[model samples]
Target: MSRPPTVWLTRASMLLVLLAIMLVSGPARAHEFRPALLRLTELADASGQGGGRFDLRLVAPALSTAGAIGEGDLTPIVPAHCELGQLRLDCGSQGLIGELGVAGLDRHPVDVIVELRFVDGTQVTAVLGPDQPTMTLDGTSDGTSGGADNDGVFADYVALGIEHILLGPDHLLFVFGLVLLVRAAGRNTRTLLWTVTAFTLAHSITLAAATLELVHVPGPPVEAGIALSILLLARELACGQTDETARDSPLLSVNESTKVSASGREALARAENSWSWRYPWVVAFGFGLLHGFGFAGALSEVGLPQGQIPLALLGFNVGVELGQLGVVALLLVLLAGGRALAGAVGLSEKTARLATRAPIWAMGGLAFAWTLDRVLGFWG
Candidate 1:
């Protein structure tokens, strides 16, 4: 069935606007995997004295398969036991490796997440990234106390949380989608403001809950959901036409032989304006809950400081919002500059109207493709 001309033009406009965003974001890097993870678990020693032997597992993939994250090779760390076909390098009963690095130890060191799980059900997770490639597990700490500074625990998690959101482009892209949903377009600052707030509040709720173990959702499922959320917003963009109510709204108007008459156009204008005001908040809050779980999932993979769970959780949420706000500010600046440049060029009103919507279309396309791939990846 042919879409109404209004719908088609609207989608076309959105696609062009987001085309730049997709290009800048590099469409090839959707849900890119993080550096290698080196997890160390301590089994319970007999007599309950603690200090059990550690088991280490490193999972890295060089390539992704459909929805699954591909692992990188570990031959550099242990050429004797590591094989090209192996997805995981296990230390077996040998305990923690004396030294660990990625394929190119000298040239390119990567992060190894060391998770020291104790018999007492506590965990101490620390990253051994390029700056700190090798780690020595001091079994003496008993895995129950603060290995890092107690007062700085919150600060550390906040930094990690910020790093996670910024580095996790998928989450940031979702925020980008939210901005498009209620950005400064046509002076929708109020709608954008409330919508962004709602997103913050909602995600904070879930991030706190999930991180605290008040609720639990697995990594893959949460990831799939985040992708779907973006997909839904994209579909919304495709179906939504420009706000004819706004004089400068890039969406086509009724007089241009749209699918509607003048009256219908007015009706659409009101609906669209209202939709912009309302939909972003509703969508942000709803999808934000899922996104929070997604945050917890990422934090889990990297591991959290057991002694400072509350601080870590809170810090991570704050970090994510800071990253989100930073991106939003950048987007607003770019948007203003783009508008200025567009006006300076004296682009036709028609061109400007449609041009603004291009980004929405691009965002939708990326989200849809990601949703499809991630959903299919559950089989892995």
Candidate 2:
């Protein structure tokens, strides 16, 4: 018996969904190579009148379940200068107090642990808890002393921003989605360049505004929104309707054909067709705004120096852009090389065309899986 058109479509959709799911969730691979390093710097009161004794404690687990941080833990990994409170006395005009250093510790979501104790035995910890009040270390005895210095503070902010984007899975996933979109769309070199540029411009605006306190959007909502963006992209891919140009590309047609066996010839055709120069840039610009806010949240956690907010914001944005560019570069190289090889081998263009569907389906599935996970996480 012949299947109904609707049934066939449903089956096809389901298959596509499954493929996307597998692509994303196939491996429980570690998203980041290394955890963010937690650095604690302490300055003690130089008056020498206050007690030198203070408490040092860590609220979060310092190691993963794999026991990778075994033996040499927070205490040992911490730099020697700050370990014994030497750096505390070295903060120039700022009265040096007791310093405790913790390093090489790993945690998810957030890193960095700090605790302060007074001679009277009163202690403060950086753990986010009701009992432990959050304290802003403003480089002053009164907690509001230092006017934000532009130099050191901005440098730190920029470094942190770069590190956060590099290690952030959500950000990476968003970037990966963009790359897939570009690939599927068969964007030309000019288009790819412009798209990346647009994304950079868009995100940089939000990141700066948000970081500078000019705009304040809550973290949770922004994160949830980011996950939603991923879902939207996945939906687009699964629906198999992006732009008309992307869907009807001749290169894609050749790549999709199962009859193509020559990898070299296939590669060459892909190179020739990969040059659509406008649509992808527009898409990137739109999505880049969402990503920038995401980056802002991470940078804000460390607290930027008011005076150097611009520098820090700029640096952080630069880092994120670099990471995005790196991903795009890799994708271009892989696709270009693959197409070249296929073309040389005289692969059947039809077979090559058919091959493009696998990656699309796989990415869509993964996006769907991530979306589901995020939704459940939010509600559940």
Judging by TM-score against the true structure, name the best candidate: 1
Best by lDDT: 1
Error of 1 at 123 (Å): 6.4
Candidate lDDT scores, in order, read 0.59, 0.50
What is candidate 2's lDDT per residue for 67-127, written digit by digit as tens? Answer: 4444445432322222334323233333233223344333223344333434333333232
User: Roughly what TM-score does model 2 have, to 2 decimal places?
Assistant: 0.59
lDDT of 2 at 216: 85
The Cα error of candidate 1 at residue 182, in Å, is 2.1
Residue 136 of candidate 1: its Cα lDDT?
45
User: Which digits, one per residue and each the tens of the lDDT, describe model 1 over residues 1-380?
Assistant: 98755566677666565665556433333334344565655555567734435455675533222333333334335423323223334444443334444443334333444455655676666555556555443334543223534445566556655666666667777777777656523436667767777887898899778867889877777777787787777665544454342333323222343344465366555546665435768878988898877766655555566666777667767776776777888887787787788768765555666666676666767666666666677895
